[model samples]
Target: PGGVGRQLLQKPTPAPAQHPPVRYPLTGEPRILFWAQNFSVVQGSKWVDLTSQTFGAEASVDVSGSSWSSNDSRLVLKYANVLGSPLTATFHMTSRWFPVSGRDWFQLNRLELATPSARPTVFNASQVTAPSNYSWHCAHLSSLPGFGAGLRGHGPSPSWGVLLQDVQVPAGTPGFSPGSGRGSGREGLGGVLAGACLDEPFPPP
Candidate 1:
């Protein structure tokens, strides 16, 4: 009986090894970074002035140590609150087991938009923050907001993300105090009068 059982089971074949994909000529990860805007809860329709000093604020997420990859066909990147953190998401991929470096065609963006809302994982704060007072002052900002993937370049060619990496925050930018946009004393704050009381280490919100 033991001999007959051995014959019933056959050896299985192994899968082929996958290799790293080559980037498009002059094309690669978007390499773009974005900072979400946070602001105070003021009454009435208050136009968030980008010119004057914003009392306290920051971009959506820290853009330092950030990069992108188009190779993530089925990848679910999370918008992390911390710099250099992986973009995490409840990826609704058809499968998880992929050959290493295999081009898995998964819809990561669709998975994110499929849900009602996206929850904050790291940079969760009770108060609000704002973007930079000056439009061009941001580390990776050009002129407008990005689309699904990121900032599209000019013409039919279309541009991807082109923000600077490893950007550091100054006293007046945003997301300094409270680690969630409460530092009012920083310099370029656009008209958001956070005058005086800057000697303290942390913010006073």
Candidate 2:
């Protein structure tokens, strides 16, 4: 039989209303992660309405979570847009996760994580999980440089556009949506998404 082809057809684990928490380096903030292969929408608005902000899916998702340590982080502010003139429009965001006990937002979250220019990495339960207790499946997207993605790095890419399998949003925080696009990869070590560029705006449509 076609083992590889058959495996592809298999069903996915019904994600939990609350996906398990993952702790990124430095900041031990907790974020909910998932493995979304693809996502699309067929709302009423197309280009004219959206460009003028007339109406449609102007949604947002607040990602906040706590890790085993003190670190906490919030990321990816999403919204629906028609890719108007100004290419950049808070399409998505990434922020830093702090290392503390209480709660706080990260500083170096960066802008690419949420933007379409962002990378396509994978996150598998085998990679980010703790050595002691691993429960969820592993997922990876593009890779960022400097931080230390380590031995687990899957060498640059995958066969298709890697969806936002799962994120590390806080348990209670909600999230936003920017529709869809092809993501890029960060060529560094442990360079996860942080939220400085996440809130900025780019070109004009």
Candidate 3:
């Protein structure tokens, strides 16, 4: 009986070894996030010109028609990785068009950016930052037979421009490696044009 009790008391058979938790790597690639605010059109203004510039590339959109003003619209553009060494990525733009009427009008949706070689990137309204009052002017083309654009001409007063910010994805972000070609499962940025409410006074008062 004493021997049995001693065996029961012997150190409880030593607990299993505890190991440290594993840590995943983060993707340090540079990304640019930008959006527009205070976007409104005056009566008789048939079209507005929007431009986004970054990483030595520029994207311009001429927004026209009353339907665009009535509902939320999204625009996405994709370009070859400007940061890449050989510079072999192609350039393209994609626009997501939604219905102007009904429930779709109230919901804010995400935009996607895709490339031929990699997966798509998604951007949502939640990611947008506070608005800044950059002067965004409409361009007037003489061939179009309209008022002169504002940034260059004394045309209509300039409107607020888009806000641009640099952001980085956490380690282990998918589709970041050159030719990794795997989906990150997380939303990413792409060429898109969308209409949604922004933080008040995005262009600033």
Order of candidate numbers by TM-score, starting with the best: 3, 2, 1
| Candidate 1 lDDT, 1-205, residue by residue in tens | 9988887886767532222211111133322212213211111233222211211233232223222343332222223421222333221222122466453322212222111232322211111112222111122222124311222333332111222211112212221332112334224342332221111222332
Total backbone clashes of candidate 3, pairs 3 or more residues apart or in separate chains: 25
User: Per-residue CA lDDT of candidate 2, range 1-205, in tens?
Assistant: 6999999999997733322222222133323222222222111333122211311233233323212222433333233443322222111212333355333332222222123554432233222222111111212222323222211323454212212222221222222122111132222111333311121111121
Return whichever of 1 and 2 wins on lDDT.
2
lDDT of 2 at 205: 19
Count clashing pairs, candidate 1.
25
- Models ranked on lDDT: 2, 1, 3
Residue 68's lDDT within candidate 3 is 17
Number of the candidate with higher TM-score, 1 or 2? 2
**Model 2, residue 176: displacement in angstroms?**
22
Q: How much is 169 displaced in model 3, in angstroms?
A: 20
Off by over 4 Å in 2: 1-59, 62-121, 130-142, 150-205
Question: Each prediction's Cα lDDT score?
Answer: 0.24, 0.26, 0.23
Error at 119, model 1, angstroms: 26
For model 2, what is the error of residue 195's alpha carbon versus the real structure, in angstroms, after optimal superposition? 20
